[model samples]
Target chain A: MKRRTFLITTTAALAAASIPVARYYSNGKKNYPPLIMPEELGNFCEEKVIREIGDQYRKQVPQESEKAKLQQILLTDDAGKLTAVSDNAAIAALLDKKIQDDFNSSRILVLSGWVISVTEARQCALFSLT
Target chain B: MHIDARQLDNQSVIEGDICIIGAGAAGISMALDLENSAHKVILLEGGGMEYDDRVQELYNGKLTGHPYYPMKASRLHYFGGSTGHWGGMCSTFDEIDFEKRDWVENSGWPITLKDISPFYPKAHEILDLGAFEWGAEYWVKQNNALKLLPLDDNIIWSKMWHFSPPTRFGTKYKDAVVNAKNIHLYTYANVVDIVATDNVASIKQVTIKNYAGKEHTVKAKKFVLACCSIQTSRLLLASNKQAPHGLGNDNDLVGRYFMEHAELKTGEMWLNHTEPLSFYLMGDKTKVRAELAISPQKQKELGILNATVSLMPLAMSKNTIPSIKIWSQDDPRKALDTFHKYSNLDKRNYIQKLFSKGFYQSYGLYTRSEQLPNPDSRVVLSEEKDELGVPRANLHWALSPIDKKTVYTINKVLGQQIGAARLGRVKLYDFLLNDDPQLPDYTSGGWHHMGTTRMHEDPKKGVVDANCRIHGIDNLYVAGSSCYTTGGAVNPTLTLVAISLRLSDHLKKTM
Candidate 1:
């Protein structure tokens, strides 16, 4: 199946469950919920793993400002987000790129003693909120 | 023939064509190489066939710079020397290890790996290793189960290592050495002082003493010090009657440039999926294994020293203690016991269950790396002397910024590689995350001492020449790791024996 078709099917399947969303303004003009949702990450990892990674992320990057900066980097279309995503597949592809970019650019964190990209940490943080 | 030096009468003079001081791996290899040759070879060992408390005490010394293993327990003083306890991991040095790396200060050897390549087969035989093959592809081709990690070949490569049935030279080669017509093995014949001519141009004879109070002189046309790196330098620095500084100390480089393989657990690798990394596993049945090594180009590009990374199942590795901590007992026997106790902890059934269940796909990344030769990291003659009246060695194992940086960079690059491959993520230890150059308290060495009497063509830069002969001294040579210009990432035994055989060949030609 095509990636757009897969994302639309996933969104339809996950529509029964409520996902808490946070709003952020891009270019100080438009407001949208996070492109990648915490519920969306369930397709990749377990809830326990996400929570454990979230705890580690908070410990290593303790400052709220630093966490906010990383979250912004993940959510914003300006810096590391390489594409305009209309669905979960595009967001997943973008997340993969950001993770690779984080590694290539040395923007990595020791999450639960496993070196992981910032985008993965942000998704875990988003999962911890629910 | 084997003779106990203590049985000799006081002031006895023994003569030989070549006198090799120390019956460790190097001395024995050299003696075995000269077996049945036309020239007489005297192989002198300070300790006897068994471990002696009083004799082992001679290795006791002070550590002033870094936290290290108890000097007394770090090296064995008996017949086989430290090889009695050696784990018997062996590999040949890379071409880069002998090159004059511009980024590493005081790097490079007078002779390249090619110069010593011919002798490695003989070294492999001496160590009882497999067919002298050290490439990953060769071993991989032999075993279908040996699966290598798919990493960028240009950035990282697999370096192969073979395990020795760990041939204990004392037991395995004792008969060969004692039976050889031209090789005379002397036990408890500790060399005390080397007498030189008035000008200190050449070695005339050496004095050997034993606890039995028997003092004797051994005169030979040539002498080789194979008493390990520290003791070799100690003997040179202590022989100060003719040359007030020491024998071959005109340039004062006799006891300098000490180095060790900086070994430590640097990181953890969490695989994305469960994969049997059979190629890297080391077990009783394992004949050969591969360790991940940074390519020469990668090391040069990053300005880091040569290093290799080994993987261990995290389940057992997390419970393991650093060797420097376990090997701290003053008695080598006690230290060995402690080391064995801790090493056996991983063999429990619960650890085996963890592996069988495939619950955790994580591995501990361990580094065995080269240390840049720092002159300050050296051995000096201590004012305090041992029971033999010869001064004990004082080790100051100082490490430079490059040492810690090389380790940190290795883990970091490996992390990058894992991410690129999507294999897994690599989490560096907290100690490596900082920008500080100092090594962590857990940092340890492989107990493979080297580079005290480094080899170089120029007398100003090294104590020995390219041929392992002490510069400016016609007949004195160092036939061990003391002549090593740099200690590569692999264990030093294979290279030390290969070079010793090379030195033996040189002696055969000149004598």
Candidate 2:
């Protein structure tokens, strides 16, 4: 087979493996490059201890404006089908929801408003002026 | 002179007690080991000092790999070698890394971690770290500012990375090494070939050349190839006068098993949850190391053989780009320089805020997976030779499917756990995500390379033996990651240093 054709087929197979059954081939719209490449992520996540969520995007900010930006990083959701986060309110609310969810998950926490993470002791924290 | 000296026209006339080739990490380390030993040592480095302008001319706008000016010392020449510009983050190999795994094909080391424990302390000393310690205890005394992840069940954990104080080997150890009585480090000296007397059984003498087109040779009782992985293997493959192929390419394993950490472009990761921020285990956390941890047992359960994931802060919560923040925030290139200018508390406070304000500079966990030995990833002899006329090595590397899978699993687990624990939101990132394993991710090729010319109980599987001696060859040994059979979840430098120190002990014992 031609290299290009082979690549196209393999790419399709990979895309299928990554996205959940709920996701589908778009009507030829722009696709976000899958951020996570194929290197083994880590086997630890497979432990029954932590549950897996099919829908990667979970929004806590019931707000509309920030939800678009949250989806921008969290999911590609049918591309043009979903409204993009175009407003500052959406970005702020979306950031807040994401932070709150991680915080609830214990991925984020506060002490004197100074954030702390459980991943690596010395590193891994987002800095912001609230 | 400690420098290997002999007429190029008559290699048979060369003489020295010890002849070392490929003056990179391993070579230099061993050279440092033998500095004042009883024997006279001759060192032949393949590359010249201070970045050969002539060789730089050859790179001549041919920017092909990783987009880094392409004209870099993927192997450096000269006195101090590649350590000339290294971001020194050091860690030792875990004991589990030495065990043979039924899961990973050809995954096991001839030597166990215990065998090298004695040398770990010394290796740390050479790298100038505080001591042989890791995990939580190290953090407690420092300050419990950072939140620690629980990765190990029994042992407490703390992770500390050291900056080299801009450790340039030339400036750091130049006077001592060059002026030492027993050590002679030659500049502009390059090893072009390694030939044997009869049956590729022994390397009789090595041919050397300088940029001036002057060729020379050196002979010794024992020869240790210390150059980095590519050059060491390249020299071996290029020397095939008596052998059908080359010196140690008998099993066609001279340049096989090429491995490097494949860095992925993690696209925008959104956290439906807020990412945790920590400052407890900042600089002085060496007291209580257990507070910090990585999920290892979780890794074993997941069928992920060799990989790791660290939470890297994106430019901002909204902008998920990993590296851009360094640039977007007040010009990162000048940030370090700026940090040096001000020693005041205000400057310190400003730097801290800068560090906190929307960008974090760090590495994800090393996918310390083994580079499955593949003949395809082999480094070949390039037509463009170094200044020494020795054939330059053209590396042809392509990540196989297995490589992609290994990367995918590592990120999934780490991202999920970090996200599950609410550490931060991780955007999925596989090494092949961008379809460019060789893309300009700041973390690829991780100068932490290992595996080529690996060690094995059998000669067929490896170029060197347990003691790093090349099997069948009476007095040949290698020092560096090239001798590593199974590289574990730690820096190869510390482990390779451990192995070299063992080589150093063996050399002293035998001598």
Candidate 3:
């Protein structure tokens, strides 16, 4: 994706989510995609996983240490339908598939070039901004 | 005088004031220092001046845990020892590596880095490396063009490594050892068994054998096992006369606590800066290069293992993974040779090429980290015996949970530091981001074998004492990486030679 187009689309999604937008770069910015913090994505993934599993998560995984156990279920497609994906694309798609797989239904859509949960789209419009 | 042990009589009994087994870096350094002394030193080497297949087979054994190099070919069984193929990247172990960190179990050396600091300069000279200096500040003073990364010193600082002409001990010290008046250099004298007294309190004599079928008994006032880590422990465990479990097997700590610098390519860093980070890049003619090491303060605060990260441009790392493929070779030396054959790229120029071609600047982040001491990751006697009639050393290298945690935490720490500084971003490999019991396939051993016969103040916990003397044996001492209480991320050759020099000084005082 082109840098200027990606930034404009991502900025629009962030604006919709009520996140503040700013002049990200001054003078000459490298034409590369802006980097995202891993922990930020990790936190989003963890919360989504907990909410998806609901009461069963607390009953099965007693401690925060056991949260890693959820990774096997979240990262892999149980139905074996996760299309082969590149490393970077896999990040966004896996989370989307995880939410769909847990509910056993397709409840996600692409908005402003971002794949986000349809139910949470208005609240987390920046979900797939990267 | 230099003697070939094959010419000795079948029942010959040779005696010396001090017997140093193995003619590797440790043994040669000790012998060289003791040259012209009043004490008569007998230096025994397993193979001839060159590599020998029959003698190399003595190192053959089974590997059970975590895929490892083939036993026989992992180490060279020759006069100069493993130094024959050493890369000569030398650095001293940090003080933190020796301190008693409560977080690191089986940690703390009985002696501190200060105890061996005095001898490091002499070791550097022995290794034929440059001036007695470490850290980036010292090198920057020498070469004004060098620039350090603007990283904070408190969080991460440069750990300097000085390269050697990589003196091959066997070739470099061959003439000196042969010509030394007080030292007797004997090739093809493989130690078969160690015999101690009835109580096994002291070593009485060691039997040496040759593939030519000649046998000889060497009685000495004191014995130093200067063999590499694996064989040193293997010889100790094979001798079961007085102690059914081996000479120093009373506490079963002889072959335990084995360690290797767990070198892994774990992640990548993307920096926005257009200017080259040339200081981080090692120059062709430069003797010193720096890698990013977490500060000692950070180690205690974070409760993590000591590790250093080196960055490589992504374009230059295309063949890095193929070198690790050498691990599966039946003959590890051949595998090593294959890796060396493919590693002829000029890394610095390659990175420069990427920059000039307008390729995005991304680095392949890699680490050389310390392994927490684990008794289970050890060497034991295999069912098969060598031609010398001693059981081969079977190595089962197991990584502790702490080992995995260390790798993950350090990478995380690096990511945080880079992010906080706004110096681009780090994308950690999925394995590090997740809690997986199994390590990635790209994970490879550093070929640095250490901690088999670790030194300690207490006999129960360690095979050797602070003075490098075996626990119960009054006359037996161990030299080389085998006596290392902890294998620091730094290469072991420099420290191993320093300890050997220290042991030699102690022997001089004792005699």
Candidate 4:
């Protein structure tokens, strides 16, 4: 085979493989970044528990406008693709600080009888969309 | 010697150096303190050694305002008073409870916690509690298994509580009181009237009567009303022939400022992981447990009343009913049986089974918070008279906006602390989510009647003085929670006994 043709074919295959991976890591939305990473929740992020919390979050915050405002507060990067390449450690730290600040500032809501921080509620709100 | 007033001849006059009316925690504590003293003490009890329906009927009356436990059911008319059914939870008032906060009107007490600290050890002995120590560190150090949550001490801390074997005063001190040489206990002797001099400057004597168709007079150098708050105020208000407005009602402050510890289930705590909250759990073998209390500084900053938050297993707590709902019968015995049937006592085995499995991921939060003293919440004389011809008491229990605020803020603060520690989450009940000043129908009292004849240095401001003496009258005093200037978040038994002992000392010095 010709070297030029083989090189071009290999690069195209690699690019196609990376596209699905990026989609899997996104918030399952068309233009939004992930609000919370699964690893950030530590042992609390069981699939069943997340779905239960997501269900409750939807019940508490039914309005789309409110959900959009929460998403904006959680994801500061308007350049959506830049957030996809953002450092995982920095995102986790920022999320933790936001949860603590929500508590300090009294920005809290009760979902399924569990008093939770708005940051965590926003995460559940985003997860409910998927 | 003990005398059954029912056996005495009609119009017989009983004489003594001092006469104490009523035989409850306060009366008995004072009598016990004066045991074998030089002065002869005459102790009067309205009922016999056991519960009597006829005597209990005397306490029946109307509820004018807020929903409350029936007056007949809330108190006992027998020798031991309400101690027969008390749950035996005891804790001292915080320093903030005594101070006059700018936010809480009519708040400060003439006496501080320092004045009452000396008598608490003795009160502890009377209540069958151990070691006078209430600090959480002291209790936690003794038991290594009890671990505290990793919350900031500045925002929230553990407030320790000591449980009693629940000494029934009737059964515990009946022999001691009846056998004392200087203490003359007259059972079935209910005070009917308080007679005073022409100028009404001093009490001449009190008339006594019983269902045995007998009436008599009792004369003493000094008279002390040691009945529980309602009865004390009732007796003072009924004795109106001499003063026209009752014995100490010149300023019309006799039956005012009624208060109680507002108790209710506020919220739930959802732990991130199952926690061994041994320090917060109360078991049969556990003598001391801790509740989460807001710091004084935090309360001042928030402009809220002092409050304490208790945690329980949600599995059992969710099934339990409120005490006010269960204790609805007019008869004390029936009400108690109904309460036991529906209360957490019925789920003992279930709770034990749950406890054996260790902790759970979910818990329920209950609050016992203070109520601001309100003049409108009071006890007044009802027009309906009992068989003994004395007017029955009518209670108007009114709670304030600060009370609901206190409970709501307590649960909210606890939620914040738990979140900050990463321990768990808290979901408040629907009632606390609103800004409405009206408390929910589920709100209940601790069955602690206090502040009808409140103490103040000035006559116009209170019914009694700092020494518990009636402001305008000499040698006439009140001795019970009725003399309390303000009710704290804890139960009233221990503090009532302590203050009664203090009054005993004062009377002895004057003699």
User: Could you say which candidate leads in lDDT?
Assistant: 1
Scored against the true structure, residue B85 in model 1 reaches a CA lDDT of 79
Better of 3 and 4 by DockQ: 4
TM-scores for all candidates? 0.87, 0.67, 0.80, 0.87
> What is the TM-score (0 to 1) of candidate 2?
0.67
Candidate 3 segments exceeding 4 Å error: A1-130, B336-340, B343-351, B358-360
| Native interface contacts kept by each candidate, as a fraction | 0.18, 0.00, 0.00, 0.18
| Candidate 1: docking tier | incorrect
Q: Could you tally the backbone clashes for each prediction?
A: 0, 86, 0, 1
- What do the candidate models score in CA lDDT, each in turn? 0.81, 0.51, 0.73, 0.79
Arrange candidates by lDDT, descending.
Answer: 1, 4, 3, 2
Q: What are the runs in model 1 whose C-alpha is more than 4 Å off?
A: A1-86, A97-130, B339-350
Give residue B382's lDDT in candidate 3 (0 to 100).
86
TM-score of chain A of 1: 0.50
DockQ of each: 0.11, 0.03, 0.03, 0.09
Query: How well does candidate 4 reproduce the true complex, by DockQ?
Result: 0.09
For each candidate in turn, give its C-alpha RMSD to the true structure in angstroms.
9.8, 13.7, 12.2, 13.2
Q: Residue-wise lDDT of candidate 1 within B97-184, one digit each (tens)? A: 9999999999888899999999999999999997877878888899898888988878878889988887889989999988999998
Q: Could you tell me the lDDT of residue B363 within candidate 1?
A: 74
